[model samples]
Target: MKRLMLIGITVAALAGVAAAAPVSVEIATEPGLNVTAPQKWLQLFAEIGQTGVRIRGMRAGERPRLEELGGSRRVVGVLTRRGDLLLPGGKFRQRDRAALADYFDRVAKDGAEGVEAPRGRFDLTEKQFRTAYDALSEPLGFATKDQPPRAVVERVRDRLPIALEIDRAAERTLNNAGPLAEDLEPLTVGAALAVMLARDGLALTPEHPRGGEVRLRVAVAGDVADSWPVGYDPPASPRETAPVLFEFLSVEVEGFTLTEALDAITPRLGGLPVYWDHASIAEAGVDPASTQVRFERKRTYYKRLIDKLVFQARLKSRLRVDEAGTAFLWIGR
Candidate 1:
């Protein structure tokens, strides 16, 4: 009897602990507009809850604040005045309010907590806004595996008016570039397109803006192809005939911005120095100081770490060697 009572007590205690655990909530909203009515916000909360996000009412004497909403396992959605929807808990932001809400709702129903808020304004042109959204959302839980890039392209093409004329040659080139397996999250048109652009080296341009038509342009790096050729093959991968060695007594980095990260690691890279593109870094909104990286791989190839740093900063890296045998790590777009 005593043993049974102890078992019951332990189960009750575990249940209590589970019940006391904080719930995660993610809020989704349409494009930012001045919300003057508290009821509207409340209604939005109710609607979000109806989608099964398990939103709890604010406690007595508790106030709604963005910073306070962020928790270790919590995700909060908010809209900036620039009409951008952001997930505040170090997650990527997206502009498709419905899809974001659906995603958050799914997460919440899985016993997570999410919060949503509206924040300040920022100036962003249409193109800039689209570019930023595409860049950020590509890494988020927005692209699914098993979805072909060509299918995504077709979907995007269908959304645009029939007036848009897709270059068949460019389309073929992009298709032949192979499957994009970047992120296995959920699939969004924008995210898929970003992957395609990154992988296939193809560009999309709004050619007849007034007429609502877009044009596909094939402008792969180092190539000026007026028309994509059949059975065209990309250049062979560059192999380093000789490897360089670097000696580092020790290296430790924490919360360094891109510049600081570079400064700290470049010295350990032997004579190879990284050339940073300020404009690209600024455009990507990468603050090196905000990023943390640690490396203890002694005598390792510098190119490996340089690639990692650039990837963490949401930029690209290329290695260039001059005729003088000096190696340069080019970082940026």
Candidate 2:
């Protein structure tokens, strides 16, 4: 098995590092894709993010799939170098337009595009896009691939340019702190250690409008460690700000999972309101599992009501219509 080969290398390294009767502890996870990683936080996370963490082993094939580790049931295709997990969640749809558009304009501009289509192949014209519907268009998928619109992603072993692909989930961690990664690395390391101790998952929530969040599962061993968020200003977009991720080795958190710290510090950690109607509208417009709507349109209609009043020899006709009758018709919109 590919996993066996990948493990062979790590095991060899561990053989030397940990010697006979290494301090190894195993835990049973309800989530699949169990990690038999190193006891060290750095080594453990490094391995999980490396090429060895594959569907079956290190290499990803056409039909290659994710080992569905935790959180929601996800069937990640193949991971790009930056740890971006492209879900088989299908494509984007009309309702998902805003999110997808933001993704293309923001994150996509920074990472690689896992799948390909000629420039503007989806529809170069907005008018055409409005009339075209595809499940691949949906911004994100929360549950099963059977969901109306799924993520249409390609299998890849390496990272794509930010312009082509960015881990959308990670986007949520972007924050006002400027450069997220710069400050995030230390925090990540600390969180890795704490989560390892707690036997929990690490979730990063956005601290501000400008930043995004990324969630990581614990896969190593270690106790409390020192960590801190050394701020760095990330590149600014016309509409948003960027938070640093990190490289600061000194800032440390004691005995806390990354999620716990993020929950304590991330500006938006609890919950945010999402419009279900938006997803429903997107689903109605696109479906990859069945017939996909390739054409979309938006329709608007107005009706005028006339009331005539006659006084003496004078007759007057007036039309009155309120905005209440006004409706936004997304039908083929």
- Predicted model with the maximum TM-score: 1
For 134-246, candidate 2 gives per-residue lDDT tens digits of 21122222221221110111111011111112233322222111211111111222221221122111121111111121112212112113211111122343112211111
Q: How accurate is candidate 2 locally (lDDT)?
A: 0.23
Report the number of clashing residue pairs per model.
Answer: 17, 76
- Candidate 1, residues 1-333, lDDT tens digits: the string is 957965764564344332222335554443334454223444554555533343332333433233333332454455444434345332333334466456444334322222232211122234433443343333223343455656656555545322223456655775675554434233333333433454455544322121111233334423432222111121333344124422224344456665677776666655554454444565677755576655544544455666666677678776543322334455666
Compared with the true structure, model 1 gives a TM-score of 0.26
lDDT (C-alpha) at residue 327 in model 2:
12
Candidate 2 segments whose C-alpha is farther than 4 A from its true place: 1-119, 123-125, 130-235, 238-252, 268-333
Model 2: residue 41 alpha-carbon error in angstroms: 71
Question: What are the RMSDs of all candidates, in order?
Answer: 22.3, 29.0
